[model samples]
Target: MLRTAARRMQVRGYADAPKGDEMALTFAAGNKVFYDKKVVKQIDVPSFSGSFGILPKHVPTLAVLRPGVVTVVENDGKQTKIFVSSGTITVNDDSSVQVLAEEAHPLESLDRSAAQEALSKAQSELNSAANEKAKAEALIAVEVAEEVVKAATA
Candidate 1:
């Protein structure tokens, strides 16, 4: 009787479970939490490997982000663009995405002129760097500053 009852019960696999139309997104920079468990339709991320879009039921992934713009598309079709210096993005099987960035700012908050000045300073430092460590740091600064300038102007 126990075996018969067990056989009569139906078991559903993870893939067979109902999924939501939206995904939860959390974006953080340093100690600040920009978006915490916000439901969104889609996310576009810039990774060192390549840029890709994340949607509901997307396969689990972990990507190392580059210095570029991250676009979040809401269910209502509204879009928000944020600039990130560098970070990691994790997509979970439960349709949740978390972005941890070293530095992040809204596109409108960025100053194009200031970003340009920083870029110039980074380049100058790269040229004047006397040690390998300094040169490496300056190179990274240049890359981040260049992205900031582009994002600010865009």
Candidate 2:
């Protein structure tokens, strides 16, 4: 959580933020996404499909997320990135985006080689997996690990 929170933090659009309490974002890695004073639209890409966005008066919704870089284009045309593991998000059309993830980190803050190694390790496990359950779990690990690598390398 942040101590001195800004009025807004935008990615692809304006970020309608909470008042006062500085949001403390965390993940298995680090926090890189930012909320500036002016932002409007935001897209959170889950693992399965891709990128999804939210705007003012969009609607109330819950979405499952996948591993990918959450691309945020600020109002000034500056794009930002955040790496998310398997997670879920709750959004209200009123301009509130609540992201709850099993893992959330800033790609910019991660160690590139470490993440790459994690991806490699997960891939090895995935390749060696036998049976449905093991394969499924390994697949998830591999996916998250790959996402971490993407975030770190981005």
Candidate 3:
């Protein structure tokens, strides 16, 4: 009976083990594909609900991304940060993550001075907007610029 119990415990442990050590990540911006089926260790996303970290075997989730940075951690522990203007992140049950972004750029490529100037211009446009639609557009621009500035500084 003790041997049988030990065998059952070993089988359960094997069954409970994670399927894989890494998750597949696909990051796309409009017509451009940044990472296609790339294996990753983790991903940190800025969502409208809040920032969350995704790892292998994460529960299925769909999140609307805010204008902020998305950090992708590769299997080798190297991290890549990309600033996304807006996006939707989908985590599948099969250990895959897909990010569809409206606009995205590497954080290292951002210029702090240029981002600051854009933020100032967006703020000025928001102040001078004549209609509700224009104001809304300017507000979005301001938010994106602000996030860009933050990413550049970081």
lDDT of 2 at 37: 32
Q: Is candidate 1 or candidate 3 better by TM-score?
A: 1
Q: What is the lDDT, from 0 to 100, of the residue 73 in candidate 1?
A: 96
- What tens digits encode model 1's per-residue C-alpha lDDT throughout 1-154? 9888887685643532227667999999985788999999999999999999999888788999999999999889999999999999999888899999999999999999999999999999999999999999999999999999999989
Better by lDDT, candidate 3 or 2 = 3
Q: What is the lDDT of residue 131 in candidate 2?
A: 88
Give me the runs in candidate 1 sitting further than 4 Å from their true place.
Answer: 1-18
Model 3 lDDT tens row, 50-129: 99999988878899999999999998889999999998999887888999999999988999999999999999999999
Candidate 2, TM-score vs. the true structure?
0.64
Name every residue pair that clashes in candidate 1. none
Order of models, best TM-score first? 1, 3, 2
Let me know the TM-score candidate 3 reaches against the reference structure.
0.86
- The alpha-carbon RMSD values of the candidates against the true structure, listed in the order shown, are 6.8, 12.4, 7.4
Q: Rate the local accuracy (lDDT) of all candidates.
A: 0.92, 0.61, 0.92
lDDT string for model 2 (10-124, tens) is: 3246335544322222222233334433343445456465567754445566777787776655545566676767677666544455665665666677788998888888888
Weakest ten-residue segment in model 3 by summed lDDT: 12-21
- Whichever of 1 and 2 has more TM-score, that candidate is 1
- Tell me the lDDT of model 2 at 133: 89
Determine which window of 10 residues in candidate 2 has minimal summed lDDT.
21-30
Please give the distance, in angstroms, between residue 74's alpha carbon in candidate 1 and its true position after superposition: 0.8
